[model samples]
Target: MHWRVPLSWLAVLCLARLQPSQAELGGAMCHKLGLRGECEVQQDCMCLCFHVTADNSTLVDAAYFGELGYELILFTPLVHFYHSRGILRSTVGPAGSAPFYRFSPHHREVDVQRHYCLGPYSNPSPHMYRREWNFDAWIPPNLHEQYKGQGQAILGDGKPLMIVHNKYNQEWGAAPTNFISISTLIALFSMLKDRYRIVYIRPDPRQNLPGFGADHNHAEDFDDHEHLRKHHPKVLLFQDILQQQRNGTRPDLNYNELQLMLHADSERFVSVLGGNSVIASYFAGVNIIYAVKGSELTGHGLKDREFDLVYPRLGPNGKGTILTVSTTQHLLQAAANEFLQQQGDTEAGRTVLEASHRTHKPHRS
Candidate 1:
């Protein structure tokens, strides 16, 4: 829902870590958020501490603490939001807030732990203290209304629907992040289109590719659009992604059309180290199809199987088999079909999709 962030926010986030005056409480800005008391940056039993200055504003020093042994996972303009793949903007905060500082959650579950930090860091948010609330992982708290369109996508009347999440095209060092090149995704889609309508989801052309140290190419540098157009003319671009960025601005969390689009559409989710993978991993019933490839691919655990929801977990019925498939060519189509059959199309409004006897693409083949 928001537009291009002003340069100021971008500038502050440049380092994402800075030395704060240890003596001062929350900064002036922090005071405005209501953290009046002296706010010292100290590690909680589980939370990362933020420095409060004279103004009472909180300061995030993720890198410094990370060096001291705290694990820091920072994503930026290159990381996609869990709700969609077309747009790439990264932050662990609920609403794509900038320069987030996370402490190891009281619970390892990210979906449950994030609510503690909602709103201003200065506010009386749950994140200020640690407590265990007994609730299953349902959905992330404070989701903007737009992220609610998932039900519509589930309604193909049992026809197969697939969401292929192509994370980043960039490589981490010499290692690949289980990346399926756009051309390959196009090929897979071609193989699947006859049986199931497939959606190829990836970062929008306007977003930055991962700039590990030097991949910071201009937005125009991305060939996602070019490749999709060139090879897979029939593959859809997960509509939400291109539509929002057509005029030059990437989609914002404030009005996440991506969340709505993915929710309404995606069923069998496939991606490696992408945000969409994160969504599928935690949200119950959606089948998982991934194998780790990047050394740092687990960077934010965005695409890793290890990361999962916390408090609100799906009942046993929500559990689906996490398939293991190799990148070998001969195995892909058959494996994908088997995976889909294991977790068939979810009924509209149901969190768990029922397993169907439907064999993807068999009739056509």
Candidate 2:
């Protein structure tokens, strides 16, 4: 595992210590990473091209190229995971530092003019850590039409849909620190369960979906599945939805594909940090991301962080609203305010929770 840099000042210090011309900095940094003559460094501070590993990293990096209207050739273990999100040009490669061609899209493995080795972070490259994120060009395909309303059937209700995703695996340590608590969910659910058809999602690698796997090998520290089923019976679980879809006509739809279709049809999402949150931000909507700790909360400073400036541009119009919260209280407050339109101590807009199973055609992408 990569060493977790807990302090944000340390990153700032490293940047401050770097003293070189933009061109020299690029060349020096490249050579320092043992890419001396292999990669061509551009005159500008940013590299002309690069490759990234990991699911979220690949999405952000590929989207950067997509925004520039440049075709990106991705080599990822989860080929369909990226492909389902509208990344049509991707190839399968073994995970981790394995032997593979970096530039095979043009069949040019030798004498490549531009390409850089990107660090395994969500951002495209270490130098472009402050780069603006873009998923405006990655509008998900209209699979509802292709699959003949498989996503529409999943909506299962006429109420406005809200996608909720949470994670409870070990992150940065032995304990799971950043996750949406059950109590918080109950509180948020009580407020909006009547107004929205909540779809709770938590992907498990045990499902054995092709080109997809767990966030990491870390064991799950907590399970909210049974709790939600027992208490919030009206809330629709994604696994259940998948099983229903499997028994239907379009059983070929992969996990990622179904998720993309469902998300594209909805306008409200609630997710925790990690790849779940990243994926939720892709669709044009209001994404409430609860992240207590991580590089996302620390790096790039508080005023100009990626969550504030970059993540919002993930939508097609570059106008998606992403509200980041650090605590469960903040999450509940934001939900009540944004989703419920209730502020501080005001119980206005509270409605009785009612189940809605009436199927309707969801909005097309």
Candidate 3:
């Protein structure tokens, strides 16, 4: 007969994959999530697409489009001035992850992946906080459903809207993604309740409560319901984590769901962000994060390249103002003063800035 392995041994084997040696975790963290993949620099490639701006305006090609195409080695008979496929993505804009490669199936022979945008584009990373291009096939299948049924939209009703998200995954850091303290968020949202409307992007749908897998069979072990409802009054609660399991309906934003006007109407967004927020706020045209005092580029899961790629205008924690950074309060106030000041909502923002600058003197790293 055959012998069966103990459950304990199985558990150990499963956990081993997560604990890639210090060398693996220490090196180049993938920009995708900074939790997996060993690639440090993020595989870089270039493509020429028929680009369209967010307002349906066509954008002029950067420098020499034909030269760039030839450099990319595309032997094409019809290289149009307007990249019809368009500038597909950026760290800051509706286009989503600018670096995540994509290829048009119809033009599979053309190896270069396609990219574009649907709105006012933020510059890619260091250039600006967001970028814009045009869309080819970026539309989601659930467009109508999300438009009709997507849970909530934290819009600005004469208030500065701020979206904050914190993810928890067992693969990050020494333990799972635990460094993002919910209490810290509560404190943050509480501080600006009067001036800002706070929205909390839930723990990623892919994530599960402690001790529970994707199946969430042991969701009972998690008991943060009262804590969330009671203490998190200042912040908007989208849904209850512990409740989704008991109801059998997984309450979280689906990939398709994000495309339907998710942040299109937002004023500002703040988070200990990742690819998801970067793209969503790109859609909204606003993504800002509070650089926690003394933390390098926000925290453990962030890569400097990713930070630079999305927001070069702001620096990590307190390194300098633009290149090298300053305080989130100082930097953000400047951005708010400049970017949204013309939008006719400056007085309140300035007040928040002054308050934040005085109280949250982001310690220079």
Candidate 4:
């Protein structure tokens, strides 16, 4: 559901009187409009709100009104709005309880399930809100003709499923899947929906940035799809790694190491770009699986050695087709151990080894 800042003249009057100062007015307006904290606020105070009720690009045009003195409010009615405005079957309730509403399917004997409730104090109460207003009420027959004529997209057979993976890269020993993983998922789902009579699978916890390094790099790569496709072939993978790295707060692996990893895995491995060398893999296509740590890659070895062994090959198209795991903790620990061992601090090396060992364990849900 989306909330629209009330745009009535009364609302403007309230705003003008309640907040005389520009700063206070801007702050209050933003808060009431449910805007993100980073939304650009020009000195002149122009603002536009967008609602992606249908197409993803529906909000693009609305975003360009930049006079800095106007407010744009976008409204998106609920999906069930049309389905909840008809004659509903009713049920009597216990004494003091609100009356309930139901709507059974045309040919069914049993009463329909109750999906919405109407309290005594609810607006348009009792009969209309409870007995007569069914949340699943059938669409009006006249409107059905119009709807069918509109040629709306139809959902193919089967249910939509979403897959969400967390800390996906830490297991692969390289980096995380980039925006390619997500964009690929979206593209593949769209295609599959057209042919297989299958519903779309929406994957979640998809990395947007691996960490600070990735965050910085993403700023550089923004909107330069051509540069990203050429210079950072696995740009999406780079974003995932950078996002994770920033989240983990790891400080090692500066820009040079990040660039090297990006270059190193351009064709096959999905490097998280910046941050540690941890990599994660995600399966594409139907019925995909996500690989967690310990299920694969047991026993100890150098960070690079382990990474080379675990990072899987991309498909013939130089794009990921299956899932993998990745991480940088081991590399960091290994580096610390090597430094301590070089200084002849055997105890410190041992301590680092133990700590690294513990770090590799999977976090419990």
- lDDT (CA) per prediction: 0.35, 0.51, 0.33, 0.25
lDDT of 2 by residue, 1-365 (tens): 22223235322312233335643654564544333221223332122222333432221112111100011111121122334443223222211111121222211111112223332222132332344543322333222233334455666558878899887766665687877788777877878788788889876656554324333336473567888889998899988877777789667655666776688778788888776776676666688888778766666664326676555655545467888776666666566656776323345333211121112211111
Which has the greatest lDDT? 2
Of the two candidates 1 and 3, the one with more favorable TM-score, higher being better, is 1
**Please, what are the lDDT tens digits per residue for candidate 4 over residues 1-365?**
22322335313312232324543544554444443221222232222222233322212000111110001000000111212322111212111111001121111112111112212111121111122222221121111112221111211123221222222222234444432244433332232222222211111223222111111111212233334345434223333444455456544433222322232222122222211212222111211222223322332323222223222221211123332223333432433332345446576556556655746532111
* Higher-ranked by lDDT: 1 or 4: 1
In model 2, the Cα lDDT at residue 107 comes to 16
After superposing candidate 1, which stretches have Cα over 4 Å from the reference?
Answer: 1-160, 169-176, 204-224, 239-255, 294-321, 324-335, 339-365
- After the best TM-score superposition of candidate 3, give how far the Cα of residue 6 lies from its true spot, in angstroms: 59
Using TM-score as the measure, name the better of candidate 1 and candidate 4: 1
Better of 2 and 3 by lDDT: 2
Tens digit of per-residue lDDT, candidate 1, span 9-57: 4334321332465313334433433323233322211122233344533
Off by over 4 Å in 2: 1-90, 93-128, 131-150, 207-211, 300-304, 342-365
Ranking by TM-score: 2, 1, 3, 4
Looking at candidate 4, the ten consecutive residues that score lowest on lDDT are 68-77
RMSD of each: 13.4, 12.9, 17.4, 23.1
**Could you give me the TM-score of model 1 versus the true structure?**
0.46
TM-score of each: 0.46, 0.60, 0.39, 0.17
lDDT of 2: 0.51
Error of 2 at 141 (Å): 9.3
